[model samples]
Target: MAPHLADWRGRYVGSALAVVKPADTRQVAAVVRACAAANVPMVPQGGNTGLCGGATPLPDGRSVVINLSRMNRIRSVDAANNALIAEAGCTLAAVQQAADAENRLFPLSLASEGSCLVGGNLSTNAGGVQVLRYGNMRDLVLGVEVVLPDGRIWDGLRALRKDNTGYDLKQLFIGAEGTLGIVTAAVLKLFPRPRARATAWLAVPHPAVAVELLGFLRARCGERVTAFEIVGRAALELVLRHIPGARSPLAGDHGWCVLLELTDTLDAQALDAMLESAIAAALDTGLVTDTAIAASVAQAAALWALRENISEAQKIEGVSIKHDISVPVSRIPEFLERAHAELTAMWPGVRIVAFGHIGDGNLHYNLSKPDALDNAAFVSRTAEVNRVVHDLVASLQGSISAEHGLGQLKRDENARYKSDLELELMRAVKSAFDPRGLMNPGKVL
Candidate 1:
């Protein structure tokens, strides 16, 4: 308790009996054993940047917070094997830099990469702008070394690409949100760094056009379409207005805008020309309304900054009700249309900010009122808003919690969406791995 109790986003504030800083896995295991012997709950925290309140503990003061920041280390970098082993506490940016040093790439990236820990990224199975190409954190991870709740170390850290062994145990803890165990370290997959990239900001007539354009680009460029993101007009306006010096990528705001990124292991000049011709073709066919291609690396990053700064802009605007729901790519247009119509009819003057990795059919649908209200009033309506949005997600056969795990925020709601049989099997696995339930409790079943 020397530094202070953790308070993140001004939402979760918990007092820890003692905040333990362990230097390594052995120290973590010993701390876990001591807590288990005393029958005290242990809340594992990393970076304290999670939006779902997973890293924050309860206010009851019945637990000791085990912060993983001190365990930062790059254990190994096997360039030939195409894998890198890093401790759980290493910052994600640091991991990416390590991979870069070896002429490889670690593609798990988010706006919080500078501060978020590798352990937290794995725990949540984070999917950022690049998920459409690299998949989520779960896919990027090859193996993990976890310390069980009972202080037993399960070392499954293997860097092999093709390991079809019985029951991939690494998965259980990867997205478990630390409910099952403490992820002490990870063996992550690395890819040959894409030698060249081409980026463009395109204007689409509607969400349907965005979806069709995504399909079009994929068929033409195939795997080279590394990132395809959609930004609604309102969402874009927020960034331009709130974020300083944020200029519009395109001339005027159409119905929607899409940021397309193409990366290849081939020549940069060829890729740029190819993307330019592709965009021109798309425009001729009316798939695209307008377009702006980045002329330099700085311009490309600026285009991406417009998309990445959406969340930060929203936060600055005010506390809004946010939902990270995803539907199938084919049904994205329908879902957006129906959700917007229904919600607008019910709640007038509600500003809806819809945007995300449309390539993955995941939209960060958030709500804020034009007329400001008190925090309590806004929060009190959360259940109602959730019912409307989540019910539609269910109707579309989509997931309520997409990349973000159900860390206390959506845990109960997820139970409702999942089948009884599925919940039973999950509980069985939890019991088998952590019988005493001394691990991170009140999270993800």
Candidate 2:
């Protein structure tokens, strides 16, 4: 009960009459059938690592939580077909290990991969650092097995790469946040493991240069540019202050930095030389001020640790307003400049910690409290801060909820940005899927 009632962020604490663990898809269907017969709503949860309150049940204690942790299993792995079937409850780390066992790569990575479940990742359509190359979770999945609200199991788990017979039903359940159905298993796409890799930390002049540098690398290195992430000065400072053994890759403090990685199936020496040449060219163009290329795998991991520890460091710092938003890649610099100017104007000395998958245009724009402010006061201003940030995102033709889904946290806020026709269509789809609305309620509506 304790574990199922709270979300990963600790911002949402819910209540449930009971937490039930189903061993397999048939058991899950049985539970769903029983709940539907009894007119009790169901909340389907995976690892419960969602930043939004998507997996947490409501506080009314009227719903039954279906925890999928027990259904952990890797059903099958077909290396020849480049696909693997995993149960909904399997931790992302488990799935990665399975892929690695076959000498393959499952490129959906994030800070919470160790504990986050595959079902939750598919439901949220998670985007991570490697999204610049491998795409999001939605793209990585070829098929899904879902248990609908009426207890019927839709076994659409096919590993085929192409099937244009009709409407893509799997897409509906992929990012539906369990509002449509409970995903029990999935056929995930995999790729050949990279034989060679190169990582570098570059200090950029600003966000604009980071964007230009991304284009520069992509044009020359092509798909070898696996990831390109941007880190703000404030974000790096927080990591240095809080995380042990964290060290700056560059000599001097830079306003913005970029973490780029190149991987190839070719020789390691050739990959390193290619990456070095690209960096040298960027340096000559003044796009990069200072740089640090990892000579060893350990050093590369350490450099990645700096980007990965931003969320944790901020948690240790204090309460703050957080937004997962995205805009056009070209307009990233403009968005940052406008957002900073507006947020500071509203709250003087407001600490803005902006960092994320800049190659894909997604930014984890967070606001830390001023030194003089307290926790409660800073949190209380969440609504005001969201308006300032979300409005800018909308103006730039961006999404309010980028990687994180619109759970209870941003449900209403999302309505303001969506067109009436789009909202009506979404509701129609929800109603069609779960007419009685017995599936996870108060989520993505």
* Model 1 lDDT tens row, 200-229: 999999999899999898988889998999
Q: Give a tens-digit lDDT track for model 2, residues 1-445.
A: 8989999889999998899999999999999999999999999999898988999999999999999999899999999999999999999999999999999999999999999999999999999999999999989999999999999999999999999999999999987899999999999999999999999999999899899999999998999999999999999999999999999998887999999999989899999999999999999999999999999999999999999999999988888789999999999999999999998887777889999999999999998775735546767888888999999999999999889998889999999999999999999999998999989999999
How far does residue 148 in candidate 2 sit from its true spot (Å)?
0.3
With candidate 2 superimposed using the best TM-score fit, by how many Å does residue 192's alpha carbon deviate from the native? 0.7
Clashes per candidate (backbone, < 3 Å) = 0, 0
Root-mean-square deviation of Cα positions for candidate 1 versus the true structure, in angstroms: 1.5
Candidate number achieving the greatest lDDT relative to the actual structure: 2
Highest TM-score, which number? 2
Q: Itemize residue pairs with steric clashes in candidate 2.
A: none
What TM-score against the true fold does each predicted structure earn? 0.97, 0.99
